[model samples]
Target: MNLDDDIALAHALADAAGAVIRPYFRARFVQEAKADASPVTQADREAEEAIRALIEEHRAGDGIIGEEYGAARADAERVWVLDPIDGTRAFIGGRPIFGTLIALMIEGHPVLGVIDQPISSERWIGAAGRPTRFNGKPAGTRACPELSRALFATTAPWFCGGFEALRSAAGDTLLGGDCYNYALLASGHGDLVVEEGLKLHDWAALLPVVEGAGGRMTDWHGQSLHKGSDGRVVAVGDPALLPQVLELLER
Candidate 1:
């Protein structure tokens, strides 16, 4: 497969989503709760529609798995996973940290990912065998000297276990960025992100971004992530800290 072509299409998908989402950022619109009680809005539905339309136009053979819309042609060798508005809570509250998550999975493994924050105009792109780029500039993670001095982050402590331990071990803690936290980690703005109960749409796009930016993303057990992974996730910008961090998580 020509990865460059897929990467270009992914960017177009993000652009389509962003165009649909920008106008709804702080505007009054329909917001409804899903079966899981998570918020879904008009922007979320329309953005996913926008992205899906582009994918059908450009890559009709590829499969699709989306947050607002269900799966289609899911058994294909290549699939596009999308979460149009990953942090709807933040978006509804006028926070710009929410993002559109897009990932291309080959044989159920993520090989390309994009995290785009349209309101902020920040985009991070990562592909297998390629270094990550943010806003078209190479992006690399900062060296995390040690776990104790790390800047730990999570969307919400309740989403995972061992929060208290990690919070105390790290130098500081920041909360509530959802997919944006992983993007920040890719850009060296944070050291780690641990969360759980994420669906395929939630975490699939993150693997390439974190790993491509000189970091590691895996289940709490330190195994590589895939379609069947248990929801718990750990992302460390400096790979060496994974063991120490996992040790605390296992306690």
Candidate 2:
């Protein structure tokens, strides 16, 4: 499949999601607690369904793995990973930091990805052979040499599940960014992001966005992240700093 076409489609999917999600944001949309105690709202379901319908209409053979909806056509050469509202907690609380994540994974690796922040109207796009862009301008991560100097951010320490050592090693960490953290890292606003307890939908889109911006993203052990990853992720703006960061987290 042509990658450009796929990239274009990914953005359209994000736009479709925004159309459903925008109205619900800051409009007092009622939220429900999922089984995991994470918040879910009518906006989340409707947005996913809207994106799903578009994908089905355009790319019928592709598989889909959504946060709100379960997997569909699990075995396909192409798959779309969707997280309608990556930070539902932030959304329920009327924060614009929440974003819609869309990724197109072909034969197991993400080739196209997008992080769309509807309220702010800023979108970041990354593809296999393209420069990462923020609102169509090329962007990349900033450099930070030491842990203390780095502007670190995570969703929450508890979100890391049991990676307490990793969280503690990050020094003073910022509170939350959900998908926005990766965007910040990509656009040179943040230095590092460490988080855990993520699934495919949560981490897949981020891989391309971070790496395409001349940054490095890996599992806790410094391995490549993929579809079946266990979700211990560390993203660094400068590749040279990864080893030191990894060492600290190892402690």
How well does model 2 score by local distance difference test?
0.86
Root-mean-square deviation (CA) per prediction: 0.7, 1.7
Candidate 2, 19-111: lDDT as tens digits: 999888889676788898878999999999999999999999999999999899867989999999999989988899999999988888888
Model 1 Cα lDDT, one tens digit per residue, 84-127: 99999999999999999999999989999999999989999999
TM-score of 2: 0.95
Q: Which stretches of candidate 2 lie over 4 Å from their true place?
A: 161-172
With a 3 Å backbone cut-off (N, CA, C), the pairs that clash in candidate 1 are none
